[model samples]
Structure formats: C-alpha cells, structure tokens
Target: QTDQPVTFLLKDRAPATLSIAFGASILWLLIGLSSGIVSALRRATWIDKFSQGTALAGASLQIYFVGLVLQFILVDKLGWLSSPGYVSPNDYPMEWAQGMILPWITLGFLLSAIYARLTRAGMIEVMSEDYIRTARAKGLSTRRVNFKHVLRAAITPIITVFGLDLGALLGGAVITEYVFNIPGLGKLATEAVSNVDLPVIVGTVMVAAVFIVIANIVVDLVYMVLDPKVRLA
Candidate 1:
C-alpha cells in the first residue's frame, strides 16, 4: 500500500474543479441556447451569418490558445481580472467570480458554439413541422410559437449534447485547467500521468465515470419533463 490513499488526495481538489466546470457549463449552455434561438429566428440575415462565422471560428480554436488569449487580454493587458488561479468561493465569493470568468469563458466557448449551431438547426427543423404551421395559422403570437412550441420540441438533442458535455467537463477540462494553472481534476490527472501514479489515475477515471452516469440520469429525467410523449415504462 502507498503512503496516501487516492481518495484522500482527491478529496481536497475535486470540489473546486467540479465547481468551476459546472459553473462554466451552465454559462456555456445558456449562451449557446440564446444564440441558437436568435440565429434561427433571424435566418438568412446578417446576424445569422455573423453567428455562424463566429461559431465556426470558436469550434476551430483549441482551448489552450483561447485560454492564453483571454489571459493576455483580460488579465495582463486590461487588468480586469486576476491571472489564472483558483479562488475558494466560500471564502471569497466576489474574487472567485472574477477569477473564474475568463476560465469559464475559455472552457465554454467552443461548446457554446457547438450548442448554438445545433440549436439553430434543430429550431429551423422544428419550425417547419406541421404543428408549428397550425399554431401560426391559429393567430398565436410569434414569440409564443417560437419559445413555447418551437423550443420545446427542438430541445431534445440539445439536452443530450449538454448532458455528455457536462459529464466530460466534470471529468476534467484538461487544456483549460492546465493553461489556467488551476489544480482541478484534469490537471491532477495530468500530474498523475506524468508521475506514473496508477492509483490516482484510476481514482480519477472512476470518479469521472460516476459523474457521467449521474449526468445521463439527469438528462433522462429532463427529457421526460420536456417531452410528455416520453414515458418511463
């Protein structure tokens, strides 16, 4: 046996990493959903074109590159936020938010882009369904039709993608964690690999698996709520 158990080593580090990832994922999903809805509504316009172009660019960039650029602009040049490092939210709530803003943005940007594109495609397809046409013919307001009818139908795939993304992030945002020098699970896993620490590596993987299982369960529950057609039986 080793001097320290894997769980003991991970106990102190996992919370901060998971917290950052969870917060970042929420921000990412919101931005993506809104962007996708707007782009779908404004189809074929300049706004749609701009959003598509931005999403393409974001998807192409790597997390490390994005993190570095953000640090240079936001932390080094403008002095808006502190340089990369984790701040305990319990002790310093404001500082934690300030410190996390850039990391969260960097980690989430690519995912947001993917979500936006998916959302737009789903919305466009949903809008063409017969029910949507019937709703429009019934003199329902555009806003209500789009939000209540279109989004509800279009959200299934988005929820699936979000669940997978959240689970993976909980495992680790490797490049983002490394670039920001945050002692999150990803970074810990990286260190463990470098050191050839088998126990730590195994522990991390097990924890990640648990996170994925939980996320999937949550997604299934959300799917039931979103689409009444889905039955537990």
Candidate 2:
C-alpha cells in the first residue's frame, strides 16, 4: 500500500522523537529558571527592561519567521549547520547540538520573558504582604527577607505557571523543533497531518494529554505541600 512506508516511519521515529522531547524540556527548564532568577534580581533595572523587551519580541515573532530567518542565515549563508532533519546524537552529537542551539535560545528566551514578567509581579506582591513586612521589621537581613519570605511566597504562582508551560512544551517543542528541523514530536505531528496518519496523531494527542494531566496533579500536590494554607483531600 502507498501508506505503508509512512506508517512504518511513524513506528520507528515516534519513540525517538519523544526521547528528544524529554531532553529538550530539561533545556527549557534550565533556560527559564536562570533567566527567571536574573529577572527577579533586577526587577526595576535596565537589565530587566532589556530582557523583558526581548521576551516581548520573542512573543511577537512568528515561529515560521524565526525558522525561516535561521534557515537562511545560519544554514544557508554561514553554513554552520546541515539541512534540517532529525539526527541521532550517537551519529552526530556535535552537528545536532550546533543545529539546535539557536532554536533553543530563541524559544527559551521567548518563554523566559513571559515567566520574568510573572516573577517580577509575584515578587512585588509578596514583598508587600504583612508576613514579609513582619520578617523585615524583626531585623532579618535583606537576603533573609527576600529569599525566605518573599521568594518562597512568590514562587507559588511561578510554580503554577511553570506546570502548565511544562505540560505544553512536553506535548511537543513545536515551533522550536520545526524551525530547527529537529526530528521532534512537532515535526511528526505535522507529517501525520499532511499524510492523515490517524494512529500517529492519536498517539501524539494522548501523549500530550498525559503530560498535561500529570503536570496539573503534580502542581497541586506541590502547592499544598509548600503552602500550609492550601488544604487538600
């Protein structure tokens, strides 16, 4: 049958793509956390403004635009990377990493911008709360007031948002993967759509659903544990 090859490709490639998705998610976490810490520290400074501005720019840029620009400049002109395709680290670690680097930065920075804004807002709110004021009034060091009181309270909301973000990203690193030509879940989903591979599509959807559900549950449990007021059955 004409469709046999496509079916076989899905079977062989889907697992590998899922593996990459896991590793990519970790990269996203690191990027978001590091930038978030920096953003929290420089709340009212020029650095905060610049990083937040970059995030806004990232939000505005279409994935297709980012992909096209990279493909043209990095792949075409500079010749730093091979044509986009799924690569095994075992086969070409250096090449795969080189190809994925910019896309990771692009996606990570974009998402980090959103988180930075949330973190700044949350930190400010927590700092104004009575508990935070009480800690400071009791002669706690600036670091103690910030880290132990303000940051702990502020992180609750960040953790909540992060859970949802992680769920979405785990489903697939869609734009980043597509832009970079990494053989990832997003690319597979795209191929499945064009070819109407129902099983693959269903499988991808199921995987996404599982991640979302699991993440939500984990967030709730974490919130209840971290915040004594958050009671649960």
Candidate 3:
C-alpha cells in the first residue's frame, strides 16, 4: 500500500483550484442573474424567447462538449484566447485571467441556463402576487415596482439555487476542470479514482462537504437579509 496521505497530495494544489472555482462562481452568478432578469423583463417578446431557447440549448450540452466547442471557435478558429492551462494569479495576473476565461464560460453556461429559467419563473410568479398589484395600485413606477418589490421577492429561490450551485462548483467542477486541464480538486479526485487511491478520494469528499456546508450557512444569512420574514432562531 502507498504511504502517501491525501493531505500531502492536496497541500499545494488546493488553494489554486479553490481560487479558480471562486472566481468562476462569481462570474457565473453575474452572467446568470443578468440573463435571467433580462428574460423576465422582456417576457413574451422575441428577446425572452431567444433567451429561453438559448438557455435550453446550453443546458442540453455537456460541459466537456461546451468546453471543446468553445476551444475550437475561440482558440483554434479565432485565436482570441489561449488553450486551457493554469497560471498563478499572484505571479501572472493577466495570464491567469486569460487561462481561466474558457473554463469559467464552460462551467458557467449550464449554470446560467438554470438560473435564467429559475429567475424567469420566480419573477413571473412574484409579479402576479397581490403585493405587486398593490404596488402598481399605489402608482409606483414600473421600474420601481419591478426593481424594488418584484425582484426582491422573486430572488429568494434564485439565491437558494445559486447557493447550491456555487457549493457544487466549489466542490469542484469535475468535467470542466478536466477538460480545461486545471489541476484543481476535481482533477485530483479523478486521478485518485483512476489509481484507486482511497485516501485522496476521501479527502476530496471531505473538503467538498466542508465547502458545501459553508455555502449553505452563507446562503441562509443572505436569505434572512433579503426577506425579513426569515427568522433564524
């Protein structure tokens, strides 16, 4: 039996991978929120249909497939971005950003689709609520009603989904990291599985569980802030 412990293997690699996951999650959240809000606001229009169709299409494809297609178009055809690899942000900030662009997009695309659908559904439901009608009855501007009353109420479920998705991503976007050759926890876990390294696999699972718990805690705090009705006793 091999004597190497899981912690030793993950010692230097964990932070880099975690950083990439963190950055990508933030980018994904922003893109997803924007797409969702736009689609909801433009409901029943061509823009809404287009967003819906595009998100469905994106959701259908696997992450590796998306990653490869993006690589082909952006790197092979257009030569606009570099091929997948990792660079330390501390040492080479620009290169780090460049290297991460495709991975982020690849990981974020499906997530964006999910969030778009959730946001649209949530907004539609919230808009029809009595409070929304009361706001309109009070002569609130369309903008104010939508932004202040509608969005705040509609965003709860979206935030919940975002928390779960973010936790999953932090646990490691396995296919995305693999396709992009990122030496993140996902890749490490993959290697361990292939080699039947039980300790490393267990370690990765434990780490992922920790991240997920932390994400849930953060989400609960945010939920309380967003809706005053949530009482955390």
Highest TM-score against the true fold, candidate: 1
What is the C-alpha lDDT profile of model 1 across 1-233, one tens digit per residue? Answer: 34687888787678768877888898889889988999999999999999999999988998888889889998889998887678788999887777788888886787899999999999999999999999999999999999999999999999999999889888877887788888888888888999888999999999889989999999999988988778554
The TM-score measured for candidate 2 stands at 0.78
Q: Lowest summed lDDT over 10 consecutive residues: which window, candidate 2?
A: 1-10
Q: List the residue pairs that clash in candidate 3.
A: none
lDDT of 3: 0.83
93-192: candidate 3 lDDT, tens digit per residue: 8988899888877777767888888888888898889989998999999999988888889889888887887787778767877788888888888888
Decreasing lDDT order of the candidates: 1, 3, 2
Candidate 2: segments with Cα more than 4 A from true spot = 1-11, 15-28, 31-41, 78-84, 90-92, 231-233
All candidates' lDDT scores? 0.87, 0.70, 0.83
Q: Please say which candidate is ahead in lDDT: 2 or 3.
A: 3
In model 2, the clashing pairs are none
TM-score of each candidate structure, all chains considered together: 0.95, 0.78, 0.94
lDDT of 2 by residue, 1-233 (tens): 13555446555555445554455556655665556556667786887777677767866777678777877887799987666655566788876666556665555555666666676678877877888888888899998888777777888877888789777776777766666666666677777778787877877787778888998999999988888888644
Clashes of 2: 0
Query: How much is 76 displaced in model 1, in angstroms?
Result: 1.1
